[model samples]
Target: MDLSEILIRPIQTEKADILREKNRTYEFHVRKDANKIDIAKAVESVFNVKVDSVHTVIRKGKAKRLGRFESQYPDRKRAYVTLHSGHKLDIFEGA
Candidate 1:
């Protein structure tokens, strides 16, 4: 997969922020078909950081209903990338 297509977007929840601050880890939404290696390389190249490890999770979509109609959201893949010491990505800086 292309580097640009591997990572969809960064996740910015409160929990994610805590992880970033404490563990030097960042979370991102990634393509479902992308693997751990791809995610690690993409983060390193895009953010110019040294990635120590990468963990991924697949979140199953839940069904939602509105006035007798029901639909399910698309499944998503999330990647947690931990940077090596002294390597930081200023993704949320000044935001």
Candidate 2:
């Protein structure tokens, strides 16, 4: 898959923000089929930051029901990208 198809969006919250600022780790919502290398490249391409490592987690979709019907939400993958020293994403810079 293309780099664009690997990364979906950033997850920006107080906890994640703190990690980004202090630990150089950033979180992202990514395609379920995407892996470490694909995720690293996508992060590099999208944020223009050099990635040191990539960790992924496949979050199982939660189950739901509507009376007689039962279904599960779509499972998704999340990536934890570690940036090289002295590099940071621009989006979190001004915040």
Candidate 3:
């Protein structure tokens, strides 16, 4: 998969914001098929930062019922990228 497609978007919740400030790891909503190596490369290429490691998780979809219809949310993937010490991604800087 392309780097751009691998990285869907940054998770901008309160927990993610706190981690960004106090931790060296950043969370991203990534492609379902992307692996750790791909995630690491994509993060490094897109953010211009040095990546130490990448961990991924598959978020299973949830089933819901509305009226007489049943629907399910799409399954997705997430990547937690740990950058090398003294390095940080500038995309979220000043935000």
Candidate 4:
């Protein structure tokens, strides 16, 4: 898969911010089909930082009801990438 297509976007929530600050880990919403190696490569190339490890989670779609109709949200995959020591992405410095 193309590197650009591997990572969908960064997940910038309060919890994610805390993880980045304390654990040197960054979270991203990635393509459901992408694997761990692909995510590591994508993050290394995009951020120019060495990646120590990658952890992934797949969140199942939740069902919601509108009146009598019910529908499900799309499934999402998340990756928690841990950077190597002495490396950091400036893009998230002010975040």
Candidate 5:
């Protein structure tokens, strides 16, 4: 898979921010079909950082009802990438 297609976007929630600062971990929204290896490579190429580990989480869509109307949110795949010490992604720095 192409690197651009593998990583969808960076996830910048409060918990992710804390992890980035404390553990050198970064979070990204990845393609649904992407695996750990694909994610690690994509992060390394795009950010120019050495990855120590890659962890993935699949979040299932939740069903919701509003006034007897039922709907479901899209399922999402998240990747947690840990960088080798001394390597930092520019996107996560200075902010």
Candidate 6:
């Protein structure tokens, strides 16, 4: 897959920010079909950082209801990319 297609966007919740600050890890919402290797390469190429490891999680869709109608949110895939020591990505920088 193309690099742009592999990574959807960065996940910038408070928990993700804590992980980034304390563990040298960054979180991203990636394509459902993307794997660890694809994620690692994408992060490296896009951010110019050396990735030490890549961990993925698949979150199942949740059901919802509104006034007798039912629906479900789409499933999502998340990646936790850990960078090598001394390397950091300025993902939150520059606006």
Best by TM-score: 4
Cα displacement (angstroms), candidate 2, residue 45, comes to: 1.9
Worst 10 contiguous positions by lDDT, candidate 3:
86-95
Name the runs in model 6 displaced over 4 angstroms. none
- Please give the CA lDDT of all the candidate structures: 0.91, 0.88, 0.87, 0.92, 0.91, 0.91
RMSD of every candidate to native, in Å, equals: 1.1, 1.4, 1.3, 1.1, 1.2, 1.4
Clashes of each: 0, 0, 0, 0, 0, 0
What tens-digit string does per-residue lDDT give for candidate 2 at 1-95?
78887778889889898889888999999988887988888888877889999989889999999999999999888888999999988887775
Write model 4 residue lDDT over 15-66, tens digit each, in one string.
Answer: 9999999989999999999999999999889888899999999999999999
Worst 10-residue lDDT window, candidate 4? 86-95
Assess every candidate by TM-score. 0.93, 0.89, 0.90, 0.94, 0.92, 0.92
Considering only N, C-alpha and C atoms within 3 Å, which residue pairs clash in candidate 2? Answer: none
Q: Which one wins by TM-score: 1 or 3?
A: 1
- Which lDDT tens digits does candidate 1 get at residues 1-95? 68979999999999998999999988999999999999998988888889999999999999999999999999999999999999888867656
Worst 10 residues of 1 by lDDT: 86-95
Writing each residue's lDDT as its tens digit, candidate 6 over 1-95 gives: 69878999999889988898899999999999998999999988988989999999999999999999999999999999999999998866547
Displacement of residue 56 (Cα, Å) in model 2 is 0.3
RMSD of 2: 1.4
Which stretches in model 3 have alpha-carbon errors above 4 Å? none
lDDT of 5 by residue, 13-92 (tens): 89999999999999999999998988988888887889999999999999999998999999999999999999998887
